[model samples]
Target: MAKSDKKPGTRRDILNRLKSNGCSDATTLAEVLGVTPMAIRQHLYDLQSEGLVEARAEPRPVGRPAKLWYLTEAADRYFPDAHAELAVSLIDTIRSSLGENALQALVLERSRHQTVLYRNAMEDAPDLRRKLEALAEIRSREGYMAGVEETAEGLVFVENHCPICAAAKACTGLCAMELQVFADALGPGYDVSRTDHILAGARRCAYHVTERETVDG
Candidate 1:
């Protein structure tokens, strides 16, 4: 892959600035990033091509209308919060009013729904890798920022961003429950183990998925 000319964190910084300012021109973005207008334009060009940023023409009192850059709805994922606070609060309320058993039951119910969706997606998949890839795509749409990678020994499925991080942190058992659901969704032929956990201070949640061979006794 070709490397980006923008400095490290520059893309994120640009996205953050546009997120806070709403709409701004190259001149304003340049000032915010302490770079020249030319540099800002280049970055904006790249971002626009990626469908993360958009340029709109707005009328000015003085001269011609200036084109201002704004972050697209798709770019919202790059920002913080991700609705984790609300999810965590709801989980807390359920635990407080309904008790731990109630909370477990609710999580189970949700997990069951997820299992059905995952099973449906993976049913026609031919191999373990395709099943994992399909799972990642489904999770990504649900705001997990998930992806899959191939390895010599087994496949590694990773979720870089957790939309319900706060809720998961509030209830650690959700992690184990997730592992179980994943195993169940893919059937009993594979051993799926969590290699990294975001709730445990890791930057992501990863599972090492390895297929098991059947032997006749």
Candidate 2:
């Protein structure tokens, strides 16, 4: 089949396909997605920018020319079949770098860092409006859609969704860890909640977070 016959594949689709196939050319990907090879190139560029896909030159004896595209080891994380060993390796690295207790502490410390960084960056804002805007800017830069609002109680930092987590639900534990980090950074007094109504569903995210003044035990 020609590359132009397939539909345009999203980043997730591209990653999943690559994970399963190991390597493929743009034409092959386009053929699978029912889109033009050019469209596949565009998606590949997007994925490449995110440190997912990679391309390599292939010397062919016939035809005009073609380059072989492949998924990096990083891209393999999207496939469930590959994630178990990857997770083990990641945990092993963590265990090697930090002792068990220290690893746990590191997780907490990093979460605290995320919150503190967000709060400190927005410290100069005069009002809640500006604060929320600042927070949104920060999260967007980090690939999230963040919003803040003032309810009847106090200010709330709502992370609309997590893009990375949405790609692989098995990593939702990491999302919970991040929430814990945010809570720790925001302090023990603020309430943090994760909503089910995510915008992107299993693809992206649509989350609602409400911050409270006093958190109960």
Candidate 3:
């Protein structure tokens, strides 16, 4: 058989490569997956019917028109939600196997693990204000409109917007939890206050961190 006529890789391989490339059209995908154009088209159609892919018309010259295929943004829902699902399942299993107290301890342990990860990612600097500024810049690069300010209260890292979670308000709670994690990482006796009014008009809402005064002083 001719080299070009060789059988192609599995459907999963085709789907993975397409996703990795930010969703390419059928012809491009066929080249990547080592498949015939017709086979790619058939798989694309199947994926579309399953709500895993979307197709858009591409403007072309006088020849036959072409449609670009892309993995739907909702495609992440198929695999991405599994981590959260597993977390909940593990908690439930622990509760069933042990008890509520054991489950609570497990939750606390997991919280500490998450806190450590955030802390390691944003370690403390000699200058707290500078540290906050650096962290804000990092957040901005990650798609949040973020900044730091030395307010009357203390060093504040304000997040003006969150691009990713804006569309899903229910997930905003995770953002709030992240702020608390930042505060905890900053250390004991440090106050981290979030202001709802800072980004009142924003689509998802915004947050500000303020250092609290210590009573010992």
lDDT of each: 0.81, 0.60, 0.60
| Worst ten in a row by lDDT for model 2 | 197-206
Question: What TM-score does model 3 achieve against the real structure?
Answer: 0.41
Tens digit per residue, CA lDDT, model 2, 35-75 = 77787788888888988877887778987557777766576
Total colliding residue pairs, candidate 2: 10
Off by over 4 Å in 1: 1-10, 13-82
Candidate 3's residue-wise lDDT over 129-216, tens digit each?
7667766767667655566766566565665444434222323334445656777876674666666431244322334554456787
Best model number under TM-score: 1
Please list the residue runs of candidate 2 whose C-alpha ends up more than 4 Å from where it truly belongs after superposition.
1-89, 96-100, 147-173, 187-190, 197-217
Clashing pairs in 1: none
lDDT by residue (93-145, candidate 1, tens digit) is: 99999999999988898889989999999999999889999999998888776
Predicted candidate 1, C-alpha RMSD: 12.5
Model 2, C-alpha of 184: deviation from truth (Å): 4.0
Ten contiguous residues with the weakest lDDT in model 1: 1-10
Poorest 10 consecutive residues by lDDT, candidate 3: 197-206
